[model samples]
Target: MSQPGVLLDRDGTIIVDSGYVGSVDRVEFIDGSIEAIAALNRAGIPVAVVTNQAGVARGYYGIADVEQVHKHMIAEMARHGAHVDLWLFCPYHPDGIVQAFARRSADRKPGPGMALAAAEALDLDLAKSWVVGDSPSDVGLARAVGAKPLHVGPAGSAVDNVDTFADLAAAVRFILGDGELAMVTRDERPVKFPAARFHRADSYGGAYVNELARAFATVDLEQVSRAAKILNDAHDRDAAIFACGNGGSASIANHLQCDHLKGVRNGTGVTARVLSLSTNVELFSAIANDLGYEHVFSYQLQSQARPGDVLITISSSGRSPNIVRAIDWAVANGMHTISLTGFAGGAARRRAHVCLHVDSTNYGIVEDAHQACMHLLAQYVRQSRMTPDAVASQTF
Candidate 1:
């Protein structure tokens, strides 16, 4: 049997909820949160954060913001002798404006996706673990995974039949046998990438473009539709679209800006505001010289971006630090994010709200597909807004 652990929530449980918190300055840690985790850490218990970041789907923020906040949270916890072993967030919400995430996801609270995945990865014994949060979903999650539930806050008082605590300190005390809580045994399963076979395949570019096309066929259309809706809605709301990338992806980002700002405007008269982070050589050099290369795009975003802006990141490998950092800052400020990536679809692929991924080995194939994705969104928004009578002759 695996060891026990604690699955904790984010907003309102460990941290005070400020309605879609995006910036690092806004992360307010709940009283005793750090100490409670420290208590668990001392007991050799594994800790995992399981929360629903619906803001990512609602266009209030992006997943990069979540990652950045979690990073900050971890650093703060470490200072107090606590460590969170796992992090799981479900960005999807049924009523979200971003089409890609506008559906029910198993990872959402009241569902066991996060707990189950963490359990499998860490070899956690669910029967011995505890679900700690401030909502009914938290209790429901415990039931789903066969873990004990510790409902926190006054809201939990309304719940009929579950363990309740006034705060983390109290819960930890009770769980500790004297005062508060729990624990992991881990499974070492390596990440397997069968898609890597495209690199070794026989024929033209290893028949890579064909492989890319085939892989794209499997992408969920709901995600694309969600992305399209995010773009169009941004256009309607007169929001800015910030795009970032590196190398060929940089060119693609710039080209995407042109298409969204010009093509979409010409086609739909929506006048989408677009900017390319790959541009602004002067400020980019200044930041890269002072803070480091990764700060260039993010610094610009921190100063210029406002809530409800859109971020479009074209990172063929999805691992570029600068690109990822830009997305991180943008999301924290309530920007809707779209990522175009390839290969194993690195961090950006997972962090962005809308992911347009081309699974292939060749850079040329990935960039080509990314370019097509940009055009697809620009044209999609244009066509959606155009008159029915103009649809036939307006597009090629």
Candidate 2:
């Protein structure tokens, strides 16, 4: 049997949170952190560092910088006889200034991507593991993956309904299941996310634009190709492509209709009959208000879909009842399904024939990825059908 693992958050939990520590010069290990880790090491438990380095996304540093810091951190920990088995970081932030690092990613805190990846690569049991951190996102990560959470710090910093600890030592003691510690419980208010706190015009004005660019970089070319083939085949067979989602996904779905109907037709000489199930506000609202929000997409699919039609559902969580319901109905009716999802991908990851999943927790990051994927699909189709010389001259 694999041993239980310990997932530690980097900043504030093990190291002092100095607001995006950039250089090795800035890294300061919290009191007793080394000793605590060394204790875990002595106990024969594998340890991993799972951190959200927004500095990369915020234009404060690069992935290399993060690695360098980790290198320094690891070396320091080694000097104290503690070894970190893995270091997984989420560099993207939705409000980041760096084009390469900005956007929501599943690797970020509160999402289970980093922890899950570490668990898989390390061959450990998540249900038997423990997550230790300073913020609500840290606790959230543990809960999302079924690991026990040990949130270190004042209870005020935590999200409501989680275990809290005074420091790393206390958390370690609890994880070790010794009599030295007892888990701390808390009754706290939820963390507030004020719009102004994220506004940061000076620090994050074009962060989304950079995030969008970063998101584009993460797109899987093969997945893009698969989606393209599905759409192109549907067009060739004179079948329809229907898209749906809520809010920003709805906007994307609508844009998809426009692009597939006109952009691909005019550019690639192939006509794709496309429609947005989310475009008709009156119809969707009526369905939502009267029947329930979950029934809106399913109602449309049931009414308008035919066998072999393609359904593209865009949602960040991929767990939206309406989106899932739509996919379920489409599959039963012999339609192809493609989903663009984020975070842990929810249930849609398994249900869709093709899933373009962003491993980010930020909604904006996920949407940016989905939007970029859409553009890539359209552009690839437009260019693939055009002569190289002509493709060079055309603006898509």
The C-alpha TM-scores of every prediction are 0.48, 0.52
**Candidate 1 segments exceeding 4 Å error:** 1-206
Per-residue lDDT of 138-171 in model 1, one digit per residue for the tens?
Answer: 9999999899999889643646787788877667
Model 2 alpha-carbon drift over 4 Å, by segment: 1-200, 205-218
Q: How many collisions per candidate?
A: 15, 7
Residue-by-residue lDDT tens digits, candidate 2, 1-396: 555789999999888998999899999888778767765654456789999988888888888899999999888765544578898999889998888776889889899899989988888899989999988888889999999888888657765676777889777877765664332222211111111123235324343444344344555677777898998788879899999988999999999988888888775678668999998889989999999999999998888999999999999888999999999999999999999988678888789999897755567778878888888887777777788887888888
The window of 10 residues in a row where model 1 has the poorest summed lDDT is: 183-192
lDDT of 2 at 179: 69
Evaluate model 2: give its lDDT: 0.80
- Candidate 1 local lDDT, residue 159: 69
Candidate 2 local Cα displacement, residue 131, angstroms: 26
